[model samples]
Target: MKPSIEYLQDAIEKLGVENDSKAAAALKISKQAICSYRSGERIMDDFTCIMVAKTLGIDGMEVIAAAQMEREKNEERREIWADFRKKFGVKAGIAGLAAALTLGSLAPSKANASNLELGAISCLESPVKLYIMSNLAWGGFSSKQQKCW
Candidate 1:
């Protein structure tokens, strides 16, 4: 991998520069410019790269290559993320909506009535009640009837 600005900063500190201000002073640049370079917010020019490398006693090409690698990696990651969103965004949304609908259907609706009894006794017509009544003729001829029971 190419050397990042952070790597260069570390090299500078190893060479006895205390902080960014000191490093910038060594390179004859503003502290803000050094901060921007360190943060990768601004690109370092070839001349500046060489100056920084010379100050830190390192090869300038190494510093430039590292910065270029970082920039390229950042661009590649952005492209990959954009492609992923384009490929899956609509499908993911539709899947989420379908899951919500299925779960909603599985849950009970407040508007529908339930057959289970509450505290008070209530009469509700049922097929089992009709069948029981038809099967049982409770009278003197109950035993003589066919075995509907």
Candidate 2:
């Protein structure tokens, strides 16, 4: 399971700051909040998770799930959040793989024909999967698409 502190640490590191105070300033939070997060006294809120995700260039849902899991007291609830994290992680990995394959196919080489086909398949498959999952989860496509884009 990905910890919320790991996300906080990654955000600070990505900002190239050596101290918590500077990280707090960059993150728009008090140093005490940073300390609380680092010390595991507090879990990041959804907004803060989104901020961290933006800083780390990853999906906000993954960070939000991690934070939610960290904050949950019930084992069952925590497991649900963990499941969300796993799903989001898989989605991010697939998106990354698809992007890599797509970019690789862009390279000038006849040998990349098969890769281009695979990339195209992945590109189409990812959205279809996402659409199906979103429909099942939310019961409609309109809201999710609006929020995601």
Candidate 3:
């Protein structure tokens, strides 16, 4: 897996930002936060990764995959800690395992909106699909008569 730093650098370059501080300004975040994301000290949330992808004119799934890599590494560390706690007692081990499982379950799953099946584009979120349909429904014309397509 390519490091998060590579993705961050590519985004920063694509956005024509001079450095992390400038990139942070463009994204309305702190430079330190950007640095942390690059260093894998913090994982980027889904919406933030999507916004970065949008800003960089790249696919959001790529950013999501990179962030998932970081999250998986962190999850491994958590599993190791849980295993170490197993030596204390069966109850403690079960509790640790349960906590790990709960945290893992909180990660985002694929959206399953039934009415949003647009063939190959079904992978996008339902709201985004709905937004596209709503905008395109007027035959490339907006409510204000603006061209939307």
- What does each candidate score in C-alpha RMSD? 26.1, 9.7, 16.9
Model 1, span 1-149: residue lDDT tens: 23467656665777596688777777777888777887778877666677777876655655555555455557777455455444454565687899998777554455454743442222323323444344335464555454555
Selected candidate, larger TM-score, 1 vs 3: 3
Q: Which candidate has the top score in lDDT? A: 2
lDDT of candidate 3 at residue 78, scale 0 to 100: 48
lDDT of 3 by residue, 77-137 (tens): 6455445334434554577799998765543455655544455354443555344346456
At residue 65, give the lDDT of candidate 1.
54
Candidate 1 global Cα RMSD: 26.1
Report the poorest 10 consecutive residues by lDDT, candidate 3.
80-89
lDDT of the candidates, in the order given: 0.62, 0.82, 0.66
Question: How many Å off is the CA of 146 in candidate 2?
Answer: 22
> Which residue ranges in model 3 land beyond 4 Å of their true spot?
73-149
Q: Which has the higher lDDT value, candidate number 1 or candidate number 2? A: 2
If scored against the real structure, what TM-score would every candidate get? 0.41, 0.70, 0.44
Write the residue-wise lDDT of candidate 2 on 40-112 in tens digits: 7888988888888899988788888888898899999988888888887888899999999888765646665
